[model samples]
Target chain A: MWLAKNKDEREFTGGKTDWEAAARIAEQCSGFEPDDEDEQTADEAVSCYNCRYRRWTVKSFSCLLPT
Target chain B: MEIFVGIDDSRQLDGYKAGETASLLTRAIEDKGWGKSKIPSRHRLYPNPVIGYKKHNTARSFSADIDEQYLNPFITYACTMIKSNVASGCNAGLAVVVPERMVNRDDLISYAYRVKEEQVSKEECMQLAQCPGIYLFELSGDGRGVIGALAAAGLRLTGNDGQFRGKLKLGHEEYYVATVKEIIDKTYVQQVKSMDLVRLEDDETVRMGEKVKVVLLDNLYTLMVFPTDLENPKWQTSTTHMLRMF
Candidate 1:
């Protein structure tokens, strides 16, 4: 579900459309914080796609949280 | 006179958002009696990593029917507000367009679509600013935000782009049902339509879920819904995922 991009960053392997996977992963993640309401894309109130720490990349997104 | 205002702020991850600034501008306009402003909309721009945005690549814009005399003062106020509110070391841009005075709207519209499709530069945006009735300003930093600001104005002019910032609170419950006419009366939504773009009749019923939002469509505030149960043909507000394209 994640690809280690660096020592402190990991990218979501599901790309941009895997809502269920993103939500599942976010549910267990302690660092997850909801982004601005307008920026949130997931219907699930708690999802990585809606996390403030997730930075969108070309293919998917990178978690800014330290690994 | 009617004018469209667009702003792009490249603030830090923890800084105030561009949408919030746009919203503040809208309220300030109304409070100053400068104009009756519409709900602000958020335009999603090209998200390529090369552009180097801190987070989501988006801009906020809104339209207002203001006294033509207040145009210059309004612009000055907007510029000052953005500069003061934006985070340090960030770039902020402002674009104002008077559609009635614009001679080459098609060119601006095409540029907007191009910005969403590929990498657009500040030089290109500055070049387009030469067109009449279009104003662009660099409030801070390297002024790269002008690219998004200008694109935002053009996208808003298209009358068919961007989701409105924030949500509509119709009922206190997590989910509630209302007629299309009732929804229109309670909120800025001018029309209710299906995902396929078919307008729902005023008498039609809809079940609005949590965080109901509206989008710009055909130059009106539109609330889009989808059939909740095909068997019953009941309508329900679109989910966040469904409205992502806007």
Candidate 2:
């Protein structure tokens, strides 16, 4: 995740298409609580793509939590 | 009579997920003995950020075969529930369609597609919904939810778009195989098909994950499974990652 223009906000640098990378990043994050089942897009249950604070962007999602 | 209900933006920014509202409301309807309802469908709308929405701009909708006499009370009860259950400071929208009353449905469905591709105003939404037999209610806040609520009803009425809420818990605790006939009988899964676009025969074997779910495709609630190794009786459910494209 890279620092967004907003202070303390981070976005998935790998973008949204790279599913495995997103899941790998989520595997190490403590804030990876899954969102609702319908909102989840990752096949892996514990992926950042499924993270509750990952505000979805048209290209990639920005991590809403402070990093 | 058939009553198709759609609700959108019903959850507060800090409250329940908007995707879950329809299921909760449908359960409330059944609990009141108005009629038996089917599982709700979560229809995805345009995810345009310019619309003041950044995430989860989806609507919840379902259809029910209800008694004609219960119609008035049902709508009244539903409106009351939205006001009470929806998060405070949230914009809640609700739309109900009685097939017999909506003499011309093309206009209704057209609005559903319009929300997906263009910007629609609250005035347009109310005008379209202000027809005979079609009821539109704004529960709270700016009532912008009517935009998504009416759109959802149109999409659901078209019999396409959206994924069914909740994972279909089938097979073993983790994974197992079942015949297509058994899949239909044991679960709400209407039909099973291959990712290659072929509908599997009723007797064909399909291996599925514990968390199986169906999506709306070709106007049918379908479970797209893939062959494990192109062999007979070797198939697995399509992952949520794949199904999300719908």
Candidate 3:
């Protein structure tokens, strides 16, 4: 899983290091493919404020799709 | 929120009364507030579009009903409702676009809704007026396509980024209202200022930032997501799941 800082984060934090921060902490990492393992990771990562799909209204695993 | 609803004379049949309906709606809003800062605002009354008796159903002469001479008066009423609601310090404007099909119908009806406190141009208003059969709800923002996410639900537009505003109910329990704003970008075609329209593009390949605002009406909670890629199925599925998280 790859990650990028939010818009507000970019403005607040000058470095692009937030991407590495999320990527390093990601349980299962991939290069943008939708797989069952990725889906499970996404499900477990649900409700995580630092997850790629944070602030989501749904519990779908698509949130971890290499974003 | 304070809302001033205007009914066209065409809508004002012998048994239908706009004033009484408005009063009831005000009470409902007030009751929802529970004496908090959410209390409803003061409404300004107005009588627009004089009523004229006209035959509605061609089945019989007795099917005649009262109708409006013009639609402007009803639109004016909606504007007044927004003005009063905003002046009273409500969060946003909520207009109800009623249709003839909604009257005396046994089946449930789905009315269209827009929910911004912004101003719409006269040309857009005219276009909408021509289609009186369609209901409308005006929300804040330039009626442009850039705000597609504001009104995202219940919209079925292809290749356009739309702000998904939510839905509203009208009249009885038979109606539901939803809204979406289409993003309109410009395409320069020589001397022609053509609009280059694109649907909500997927960002599956690239790791871009995303911003999402979700309103859970069932729970009355709003979720805002940011910096997520569009094409990421995880993001999409998660966003959908979060809608019902409460």
Candidate 4:
């Protein structure tokens, strides 16, 4: 699907895709990006704070939220 | 677009009944009514035609709207394929392929509203005093801000109900709406893998020492078997007759 320049409506036709290819296409087709404040707030969220019940916490695991 | 599914048909576990086990499947499909519009046919297994189409952004949510847009023809084709496939003996997982460029409006709006409400509250607005005219920086930001927040959150902001609803149609999924007005109020429950020849009926019972195969379709699990005694006064496991393709 491609939106005409400065237009909200778009056109689309079916095509083949894989996961990686889909991601690349999405990135290219997407027209907007978030502002800095939104990014900072998202970054500040303590996604791992609920993971307090553990004997060990690795750096990689620190980024994971409690299941 | 074309989608291909590889089916291993040579693997057939014989010595079981096919007719006795089909009612459960039919009842399940009837309950979901996913294939109501398609022409019914008999076969072991056939490829679903609805597997490989892209979901464009402007498509409507109502089935009627989709039919007007010519999507229903493909959906009907897919349903018919599934019905035929199940009838014939195709037992395997389905593969669906779709284009990535299409965006779902519901997903995009949902993400956008979430970003506005959660991240950029009114208190965060910064007033520019020295720009010759008054300007609030936050008030003028575009959708890029919302998209960025969604990206950071690992969320796709442009998907509609097409992907979710399409699977339901293909697999004979069941669902109930919890809320009528909300966009996200709908839910799904898969009823059957296909509406072919195998099914479960109300007055059927399976006993131990009888041959049976576990049928797993969507999320429902069932046991299939052929009767041991059709003429004897007392049906015993030892006297049962077995047929192929259960």
Per-model interface RMSD values are: 1.5, 2.1, 21.5, 24.9
- By TM-score, the best candidate is 1
DockQ for each candidate?
A: 0.72, 0.55, 0.02, 0.01
Q: List lDDT for all candidates, in order.
A: 0.88, 0.77, 0.23, 0.22
lDDT (Cα, tens digit) per residue for candidate 2, span B1-246? 888898886433356555566777678778988888877888767654544434566788888888999989988887887788766667888889887897799998888988876668889988987787789988888888888888888888887677897787775555777889998898877878777778888888887775677887676778889878857667889877667655
How many pairs in model 4 have backbone atoms within 3 A of each other, for residues 3 or more apart or on separate chains, i.e. clashes? 27
Q: Residues B1-246, candidate 3: write the lDDT tens digits.
A: 111132211111133222333344444433544221111111111111111111010000000111243234434543455434332111122233233533321111111113121222334533443443333343222222111111121111111111122221122323111111111111110111101211123222211112222222211122223223433421221232332211
Ranking, DockQ, top scorer first: 1, 2, 3, 4
Cα deviation of B245 in candidate 3 (Å)? 11
lDDT-better candidate, 1 vs 4: 1
- Candidate 2 stretches with Cα past 4 Å from truth are A1-5, A8-15, B10-14, B51-55, B117-119, B218-220
Docking class for model 4 is incorrect
Tell me the spans in candidate 4 whose CA falls farther than 4 Å from its real position. A1-67, B1-203, B216-222, B230-246
lDDT of 1 by residue, B42-76 (tens): 99887757655368778889999999999999999
Sorted by TM-score (best first), the order is 1, 2, 3, 4
- Residue B15 local lDDT, model 2: 69
**Residue A49 lDDT, candidate 1, scale 0-100:** 95
Score every model by TM-score.
0.94, 0.88, 0.23, 0.15
Off by over 4 Å in 1: A6-8, B230-233
